[model samples]
Target: MRHPSPSSWAVISICIVAIVHLALGFSFGFSVDEAHYALYAQHLAWSYFDHPPLVGWIQWPLIALTTSEGVIRLIPEALWLISVSLVYRITLELHDVIQGRSSGYLTNVLPSGPSCGLMATLAVIAAPLPHVLSIGLLPDTLLTPLSLGLMLMALRWLRKERFSLGDWIITGVLLGLAGLSKYTAVFTVVALLMVFLSAKRKPWINQPGFWLAGIIACVLISPVFYWNWVNDWISFKYQIAHGAGGTWALRRVAAFIGIQIACFGPLMVVGVYFFLKQGWRNHRLTLLALLSFFFVPFTIFAALSGGGSLPHWTTPAWFCLAPFIGIGLAKAWSQQRRRLISSLFIVQIALCLIGFGFVLAGGPPSANLKANPMADLYGWQSAGQKAAELAHANNATGIAVQNWTLGSRAAWYAQPLPVYVLDQRQDQFDLWFGQLPLGANVILLNWSGLSYVPPTGKGAGFESCRLLDSLETRRFGQLLSTFDFSLCTNWRGADLVR
Candidate 1:
């Protein structure tokens, strides 16, 4: 036999990593967020109550394929390839820029040139926070790549110091796509604007590319804006409240920083080392560009810490960080400290394996509490199926649940069950399905608890709402959760309950 070339090994590595992620996706049950997004797949919309339509749009085709929790996760995980490709292109471009045309091809002959891009790819998928959380169907899954693409385009425009109308349009389109994925993408536009107005780049703004990118981006996102207007800006308002969940605390800001540390881990160490030793002062434009590109996403999420925000709001920043890490590792190759980068890979992989260990060991410490904040993913598939059988048996005209998560989860797991959310919040379902007919029979899954019963009073959307049966989601014969069931003999209601 023959030894595989480095290129052969690279292809093999990508396949192996891809297979592992697919296995991991299957290993866990649907997260509450996954369940919610899976619900989004059911009803096509211009925009949703809680988010823009792209996540759902991504899942729309998959609806025909399968709804199994693990399979649903693939919608985002498959996108990992795109993320890596963008990173590689950008890294390769940056490498060429820094080294110059004279040295570019000569360096490409060496192993490190190509491998830097691969390293960046691995850094992203291997990182624990984004890697694990990204598996579940989520907006960040799409947003991260679009964010990187937006940055890459902006970088290209600036690196050349030329307007290139084509570059601006592509940048605008990518920015639009990113916004569709997540509003945090607005930061990319801010970054571009900041760059356009900077001292060296100021003249570039007078060109059509400057204003056209903004206009095209706005035109691209017009659907969401129009949707917001029609829906009373519910998505924007929801995001505002959600981003700032509580009063500001300096500790949260600190915690957000700490999360980046944990998420980036040893790579963060290498990044700091590169900056300190390499002294980025020489690459001021590149550094300024990198910082500005990162500032929008990081600041948007980080600033909200005063109100309340999670550290991962800076998830796309990881996309930005990867190329920097890649460039650092590439430089290390010349100095023979390349082993440091290899060691970081081992540590990151080990950390992810440990995370997988915890996830696979599903039962939480106490069933009385939300287990690992992921308990919803477990035990609910079977319950949802059973609820569907019960609803069908009772001749239910509609299956109603009290909240979005349960409603979405139940709808997916319970095939043929047209689940309606009967909560104060109006999600995609209400907009499409509208009110259940007056005097219609309903099987209400009492989300409150086992002992609860719905109001039987006239015009409370029920002629009579009585507890029918209760199902206990148990683990090893211990009750994890108990949900009361109600059979509303004749639901009388139109429009949402206030």
Candidate 2:
């Protein structure tokens, strides 16, 4: 029996790296955003106000099988890992083709690449993964492959010219599913347009394959249209208002760019640039197709959009750039420079341990970072228990939360007690349980921080409000967050009372 070579070892190591990701999920609590997404599972639907219904639908089964946050997280993390694994697989096939397999049954079956698989595999491992990405249930997590697939599949179809109609349909389905995962995927059409419009490929725009794929994609994404039409197109309008505007916060735009650079790794600056040059130098039109996916989103959402928001909104495009980084670094550097890349990977693994270890413990060890942001995940179980106890003590008929985040936590922890979120923000909680009856006593949890201004909705919106006990969530002698658990008497409409 032969031992695994260094090349194969990288692929094998991915499995171990994946296990580390799964194990860490158990340590953190649901992110503020996660509770909201997880709560989406409670009220199943065809669509949602913030996004398409795919995320809710995806989370529903996993959320049902077990409430364990770690287990719930494993679903999307598995998808992300699968995407990486696919890229690694693609590199292997590409490598075989490039390295001189004149003709063989297996050789013909595999995809070939200009670079070896090891560099691509290692670069993906070294890339920074945000806490929310690793722990939370997010649509972007689901969007990973569809976006990458759209680029990779389209590139292969254009460059190789050996693909059949089935391959074209698969590309369409991936593009459609990408749209289902996130609105950003809509730009894939525009990218493909650039591919068709390319000087070399312009004549092929009249091809039936193009129209065939377009129709299939349209069919797959039609549900989004159906849902929005039923709900007066709120989803469409909401995305526009939420992501785009003339607020003109240059600092926000700058920060977004900086965060992306940090997330991709500073070394990627060299990797991505050289990769692009090589791709253009070799496969010009094919490289442009891959690039359009990255450039269009990054330009629109990060460079142009205003407001300080999630830098990860640009993640899918950045993710598509990974294989390039791997190949770029492989070619640009000498064998000795491998030490630097290895050192970076070691740092990443160390950070995963040290950082998550601190966060899992609910605090940092004598660090200036002060409180751990991951602690937000820490307090939900305790907060839910306290809310449940207070609801029982008040003889409250039901629970009402001021915001969706608190409402989701309440729903998860305070089960069997119908929890209603009476906020202006239109979430499923508000949609499903908006019917809070009149003359019913309700237990309201108002965030102390959000209380800086006058409380509205189920908070100050109540006719008779009595102060109950404030619940303090602490970990390791540090006060994480404080919640005002109030007993509001009489049923005054949250909007009406205010």
User: Whose TM-score is greatest here?
Assistant: 2
Compute the lDDT of residue 115 as modeled in candidate 2. 39
Q: Report the CA-based lDDT of candidate 2 relative to the real structure.
A: 0.67
TM-score of 1: 0.82
Q: Write candidate 1's Cα lDDT for 149-226 as tens digits.
A: 876865565567465889878887888888888887777667766655544634765788868988987887888999
State each model's CA lDDT, in order: 0.69, 0.67
Q: lDDT by residue for model 2 over 1-498, one digit each (tens)?
A: 187764666767677777767877877677766777877787777778888877888889888878888888887677767777766665544344333343221311111243345667667666676444745668887787677777666556554545567777887788778877888777766776666566463444466766788888888888889989998898899887777655778888777777777676666665676455543333354456556777887787775555545777776766666666666666655434666666766776576567667666666645322244544656667767777898898799788776666677778777767787665566566565666786778887766434422233543456666768777766777666677777777776656432
lDDT score for residue 78 of model 2: 76
> Candidate 1 local accuracy as lDDT?
0.69
- Candidate 2 error regions (>4 Å): 1-6, 90-115, 199-209, 276-282, 365-371, 435-439, 447-460, 470-479, 495-498
- Best candidate, lDDT: 1
